[model samples]
Target: MTQGLSTPRLAALASAPPRPAPPPGEAVERCELCAEPVRDGHRHLLDLEEGEPLCACGACAVLFDGQAAGGRHYRLVPDRRRELAGFHLDGPLWAGLGVPVDLAFFSVSGTGEVTARYPSPAGALHAAVHAASWRRLAEVNPVLAELRPDVEALVVHRARGAAEHWILPIDDCFRLTALLREHWTGFTGGEAVWRHIDAFFTELKRPGRPPRR
Candidate 1:
């Protein structure tokens, strides 16, 4: 009877959703936009309408820099990565957002609407935030008020009585989401996932000039 009971549990586990794939190998390649050969360090552009990321040579990325171009299809992903020092969200404010996860990314959409997404065991889970909440957040950090629509995000992670906030490119947000979906295990993401998260933050916190406030 023990073996019979275990068989059903195994079958249920087999039907669960698959995890996100690991990060791809890093090698120089052609630009997705101009087809010009680009190095692994080439800049990226975000196709706002389609919500797709495009690898681009520097020249191609420059072409889409100005938002006033009015095409509404493509937006250049800004390279500015910033750490918001002394950022805090009280418990009541956190509860208002309704995100169960401790990490989340917030970005403005093509239509000038702010949205928040958190990584989950299944995939990126989006939670619609009220406009008033966004306004309040902007009041605290005006830099966040200037986040490029669809192409950039303000990522915040609150855990263990500490919080870290970064203004990051949208693609990086997706990368983190992929990481969580792949290696997360049990309630606390297991050992492997925590290691990966730590390494990622180390890169973000490297010694360099902070982004302009």
Candidate 2:
């Protein structure tokens, strides 16, 4: 006679944690609302119901600026980008959040759950984070309190071994995703990709805010 495994143990072994659906890649590239042709450099609006970043031409984007009226169905992603000066985070704090990568962006989704995503060759690789850990960090960095739900994120990078944080629009986060996907090579991202990444952050650090043209 052989002993059988317990039901709870068997059930636990059978189940695997679910992955967040990698957001729709290359969504329409053009304004989804008015069918206007959006340029490569364009703004985006969060399609609240669908939970996807919808491409929007300047005109259409302006319509939903701040908050979308009439039930808040859509919210325009702003152009704001600010480096979080003297942002604080240590190895233990970051590891406790449970993100597999050293560099990841944290944001809240439309339905109000925190999302931990990192740029990778595959895309923005989504991972589950410990909510309690995030709460602890938010207490230390009050700036986290200002993060806009869904359309904005707190992007942190320790790529060079020095932690850098930024409050950037969600669209910019996707741009980083696209950059990594296109230039990344096997295992470690190639030197070319690293240079590109450096340049991207350099531009972000450039003085003077981008004018609202």
Candidate 3:
């Protein structure tokens, strides 16, 4: 007798369509210094003490745009992406740098120390840059003298019998490192990783400034 009124309700409940899940809320990226939401292409600052990058809103980025703006603790990462024309790095010279990998980035630290890093599956592998070799390389490439310490890097691409050189923001170099860490596979890095690498280089060349000879 009690089930009489519930029969239709039970059938209706069973026949009702399942409700859809609510769409995920997009995560908003915020400036590390001011806690303000930043746009997709916001500026970045380098933490000199920790050698890490921090996203910044427009106003915060302008504050540290100068060399002495943040009291030497933070440096604004520039958006320059330059392809170096007539850049020279001979085979013997590359070998002297002591980086086992063909792809690597070289940067000068705040204290005038130069370090060479190459992306590996284990992360970025560091190599000692012989002082003499670096000096010779910099001597030929005068543009290197303009490289702002801790913000820019001399990125070399020599993999797959290709020789390409670019002066990119430190953030770009780190992005390449992350890309390789995510896609690299096996001893030869597989075909997929190479495709990504090619695409990355293409993007860099597309809007890049006229080659600095």
Candidate 4:
């Protein structure tokens, strides 16, 4: 199915995959749900009511993978980053969306509202997104139809002569935002920040295909 990109999608970024194993002096972060010992590569859970991701151990993440028994509580954020090579978008369409940044994320909220956000030195910044534009894109992309409500997102990037798109877990979106926050400098993000962002998309387009949807 064809995918389209224009502006940010609604959903908060996630608890980043922890950095590489810590040194002996640093403390490790344990699972907030079960207090189980967790490694840096552990997964995350989306707290629907809170609209944030909680670090979770493997067992707890799996146990709550499905919908909560009482009501919508935690939704396990799946880890998949698919390159949408067939995405559709053009100058006029993108201009209509009106996102201020080159890279942004889109997700659906618990209330089924579509939202958009972009990375910034101050962290991710939210902006107004016309729902009609989003609906039009979804109408064209069957893969985007696969985005799990509140847990997955459509990330669109346009900069430095590159056009990249992905269907990624919400957590990865936050990780991207954090990377920008830590590296951004000067008005146009300088050379260092662009370098990192370039390398990031380079890897995203690397040989390894994301797991089948």
Task: Write the number of the candidate with greater TM-score, choosing between 1 and 3.
Answer: 3
Runs of candidate 2 with Cα error greater than 4 angstroms are 1-30, 37-41, 68-72, 120-123, 208-213
Q: List, residue by residue over 11-72, the lDDT tens digit for candidate 1.
A: 33334464444357534467787798766456777766566667788788778778755277
Among the numbered candidates, top TM-score falls to 3
- Clashes per candidate (backbone, < 3 Å): 0, 0, 0, 8
Model 2, residue 59: C-alpha shift (Å): 3.4
Compared with the true structure, what per-residue lDDT tens digits does model 2 show for residues 1-213? 112212332233224243444355543346789987665457878766765567789988777775544146888887889789978788788888876666778888656678787755444467656678888888889999888888899988888674679999976776665566666686677788778777777778778643211
Task: Name the candidate that leads on lDDT.
Answer: 3
lDDT of 2 at 202: 77
| lDDT by residue for model 4 (54-142), tens | 88888887787675531587888887778898898677667766676778788876566777777654445776567788777777777
Give each model's whole-structure lDDT: 0.68, 0.70, 0.76, 0.70
Candidate 4: residue 19 lDDT (0-100)? 53
RMSD value for candidate 3? 16.2
Q: Clashing pairs in model 1? A: none
TM for candidate 1 is 0.78
The CA root-mean-square deviation of candidate 1, after full C-alpha superposition on the true structure, stands at 9.4
Question: Cα RMSDs of all predictions?
Answer: 9.4, 11.5, 16.2, 6.8
Off by over 4 Å in 4: 1-27, 68-70, 120-123, 206-213
Q: Residues 1-213, candidate 3, lDDT per residue (tens digit)?
A: 001111232233334454444345433468899998775567889888877778899999989889889877899999788889999899887887778888989999877778887756554466557778888888887988888898999999899987889998987876776666667787778888888788888877776332210
Model 1 / residue 91 / CA error / Å: 1.2
